[model samples]
Target: MKPARPWFSAGPTAKRPGWSLAGLPTDLLGRGIRAPEVVERFAYALRLTREVLQVPDDYVACYLPASDTGAVEAALWAMLGQRPVQVVAFENFGLTWAADVRDHLKLDPEVIEAPWGELPDLSRVDPAKDVVFPWNGTTSGVRVPNADFISNEREGLSICDATSAAFAMPLDWPKLDVTTFSFQKALGGEAGIGVAVLSPRAVARLDTYRAPWPIPKVLRLQDGKGFDRALATGTMINTFSVMTIEDWIDALEWAQGIGGLETLIARTDANFAALSDWVERTDWIDFLAVRPEIRSTTSVCLKFTDPRVTGLPAEDQRAFVKRFKDLLEDEGAVFDMEPHRNAPPGLRLWCGCTVERADVEAATPWLDWAFGEALR
Candidate 1:
């Protein structure tokens, strides 16, 4: 039988195997945000996050409001003016940040962009400019193959939106100055909260440099003259959902139980391998990310290359995606496997750590069936 709920949404992906609402902590449901027990659980989540991600001791990991969007904006609002900025965009989210820099922050940053499923020229990045880009383009399924493209002797900082890459892929902490992700991604936790990890250099930037514009209270890491150490130590800027915090703790514990980061990455890698094996034998489909090295193991995206589908107009191609996905959903074979609304017409499957390899394996044959049915 097919899995009961094959949640393949890019964010809020499948929960860890054997997870249920019954496993959550009940005592903290109605407690105040500053309750002693609540505070400890929040801190524990931070500690477990550090351990699971193997963050450097010199870095600080903190919870922030508004998911990954807030975290990225916070970094932008706090740090963009200290140096000239370079915004690298390969997909929608990257483009969003670039727009934020150019239009919102009004920084007039140098923009480096590429078509979907490709990467910008890394050599074009200047060390004197603060660099902003997504480590993994969730919509495009293209990831930076490695940190080698970044200069070790560079004077500028690397601020990465790692919403989809954090737990499922290996991150070189020494190479990233500010990295942000939401728990809803790889960990399969509840949404509305984001995790931001800052290197010592980033902390120094916050303490020393200030943006020329007014920083909102929610986005401020430092007051006019002093840094707010409390934000890094679990005193959040606003009231966050404590139940969501508990859910995140549950997810982190689940990650630790499964042998931590290496195990999580292996699971994602295995799932992607299973899907790739099937894709290789299937003639009608191909990866959106043409390069094997940069293909995302998390949001694995694919395009239908067969003439029957590609021959159609863009609108009809989108309809084909909807019909195919609907067939899978109707059969209970899959769920939320649709490509991102702004992405090119294709299928975007979540092969994150929380997803079971057996389920992915089972779903591939059904995909073949659905494709045939949709063409009819």
Candidate 2:
């Protein structure tokens, strides 16, 4: 039997298990962003963010434009260049940050990099240099197991691109200097906005140092006298959609109703367990992440392992992936299961909190059926 709801897109991902377009609040749809109630909604969203994510009391959480990409770029533009830098690139987004560091920022950072399925040697990266890395490798199904690599005593800050991990996994808040995430992923909220959390040290950096190049208003963190503290408290740096804010509030309310982070992580883990059980039973497929410990529970990427499939030429392998996913789509067994364009030709299944474990269990047989059909 096919799963009733088959949304598996990694981003702008599956909505909450019971979500309905008609259920989204529209009372403030066309209201001004700065109107008192709209502003309060924004503040409430931030508060819910901190409470549900268990963000540290001292860190300042602010809303920014352009989703997770904007939040990461804003941090890069506003905070880097005060000292030496390092980038741990194991996936596309991290690599993009590395590019910005080298090509755009024009800074020769110590680039600690690895291929898609592996992580860079954390021990090799200098602790005293400002470092940037993704907590969860959204594209490759690899993730840092924990913050054990971060040192408590270090001169520089830890900038984390936590876009995909925020609500699904535990974040070691104290060790992270600047952390950013999109509500679209883990929370199943609308896109086009992101939340950035700044440790006191990061805010101090904003107040003390200035970027050599002119920072765009959207990316700028501070002015001459002091940091833009108002943004930290709920003021947005740019015009925002109140309708999106309501959607965010809806998601946050659902998260809170379910008993918060522990529940969210449990839900994600349950979905992961269902899919992993299927993978173990199937001989033709295996996780893309080489190490079991680092395998992502959210975006579970897989590659075919059968000799005949693996023996296919690179282009053919890609074509096979397309045909397989297309078959599933046509059958309504899955949607958006194709690997990222930059990632290796494989399958990337979303097992995020919003996904029900039963759906994942119901969907795995489709992968087997599609593989056989595509082979024929």
Candidate 3:
């Protein structure tokens, strides 16, 4: 077998070579008298995303101040201060956002939260009210079905956090008003920057709604009429990370070079298929998600199913999993396979296309080895 390239961590994962600033289109930031070509490149990258996802021409796509947190918070700050909020918390991070809405934003939000192991019922959500839901629960490895469930003519805004699902899955942009994602998830680009895509309705809300509390410098999006037009050009706020934005553009270019979004989706599907097949054959392991349809293809989480294995003390199970990660790293077969701290004590593997199939193939043996050693 060919040697494995180290990667597999979720955020800040391995990037394709020749993607640094030195190799980027220098004129994207525009040279002297051009005001940096990078801004236009950034706009172009957003346009490509819009095209790939089939976003409406009237909608605006722009980068945000920080990661998904920044974008989501900006959306909340811009759109929710006036209305009674409803938040759907399915995982740790989602719960964190709910807390932000209540504690930080001081909005008395009715929270519909499910235990970490399961997904909240979408039927319980009232689309007539402003709602916050992640398209894919990255930490929990659960995903929402689709946007068809959301009311098309609802009075309130539908704010979505699609950080992990943006490029990996098909987003119904028409049904979604406010959506945001970070490049680090499936894009494998740099962190510290986020992409915020807003439908015309969302822009209208931002333009119309005024928060009672002071809007932070980073979260402000209103142009003049309370609507955000900066989203159309590149960004609304201030300066952006030129280097990281260039990296994101290159990542898109690389995706296009390979086979575009369709090819990338297929690659993720294949990697998930490999893991799903392996998990089916193993009697000791099983998926955390109860339903196959709801399982996330990007972040595939697994737990020991054998009674003996599960019977081990919770701490012991966690230690065993940690040892499994250490063993895989020692063998140079995988890197950063630990489950997220906020999640159950189980292995959370990223089946992203950024990882070559050969590396995934070579890593399977190490999983067997680690499982055997831990079980023994």
Candidate 4:
């Protein structure tokens, strides 16, 4: 039988168990942005974010526009170039951040890179140089296994794009200076907003250092004075959707009510374990991240190992993967399971907090069936 709940998108995944449009708070709708009630709504979301993520009290979680990319860009443009910056690129989004530093920001960074499914030799990273990397390789399904490579006494900053890691993983906040993510990913919330948790060192960088370039108003967060406390504390410098904020608040409430961070992590772990067990028993599929430890527990990516498809030319391989995607999609047994445009021919599934373990287990049989029919 087809899966009971068949969604597997890597982002904007299935909503919480009892989520409903009517259940979301709507009293703040049509209220003024700076009004006390609306401000309280945003403040409540921020409080739950810090509590759910277990972020340190000193770090400021600022809500920014443009989603995860926006939060990353704000830090890159405003704080990079003060010292030697090292950009670590592995997956697509990691490569995107590296590009922003190299091409867009026009800075020559010490780039540490690896192929899509592998991580770089992180031990080679300089302790004294400012560094940037992703906590999770969203598209490639690789993640930094730990933060032991980062030095606790480094003089430079550590900027991490944690867009796909926040709700599902444990982060070493002390080792990180700037971290960015969105509620849209693991929490199944609305898109278009990003939250950045900045360390005291990161705030100091903003206050003391200059970017040597013109900063846009939308991305700008600091001035000659210091960090913008108003924005960092949930006040919007730009016009924002109250609907989005309400959705974010609702997601956090769901997460908190379900036992907070540990429960969220446990749910994702169960989902990943269910999916991983299938990949192990199946003969035709294998994880893209060969190193099991570094394999993402949230965005689990896999490639077909069957020679029927793998032996084809590169373009033909892509065509066959597309066929597999279409076969499953047409069956309504899966959705958004195709590999990203920049990734190799493969399947990506969301095993996040919002996804039930049984749903992931249910998907495996359909996946095998789809692959067999596609081969036929």
Residue-wise C-alpha lDDT for candidate 2, range 195-252, written one tens digit per residue: 8899999999888888898888998778666689888778998998887877888888
Candidate 2 vs. true structure, TM-score = 0.98
Q: State the lDDT of candidate 4 residue by residue for 107-153, as single tens digits.
A: 99988999988999999888889999999998999999999999999
> How many residue pairs clash (N, CA or C atoms closer than 3 angstroms) in each of the candidate models, in the order given?
0, 0, 9, 0
Model 3 sits at a Cα RMSD from the real structure of 2.4
Off by over 4 Å in 2: none
Residue-by-residue lDDT tens digits, candidate 1, 101-207: 98988889888999988888888988878999899999999999988767888789999999999999999888899999998999898889998899888888988
Candidate 3, residue 209: Cα displacement in angstroms equals: 1.1
TM-score of candidate 4 relative to the true fold:
0.98
In order, the Cα lDDT scores of the candidates are 0.89, 0.90, 0.78, 0.89
In model 3, the runs with Cα more than 4 Å from the true position are: 16-22, 25-34
Per-model TM values vs. the true structure: 0.98, 0.98, 0.92, 0.98
Cα lDDT tens digits for candidate 3, 196-258? 888888888876778878888888787667866766777436666666767877888788888
Clashing pairs in 4: none
Residue pairs with backbone atoms closer than 3 Å in model 2 (clashes): none
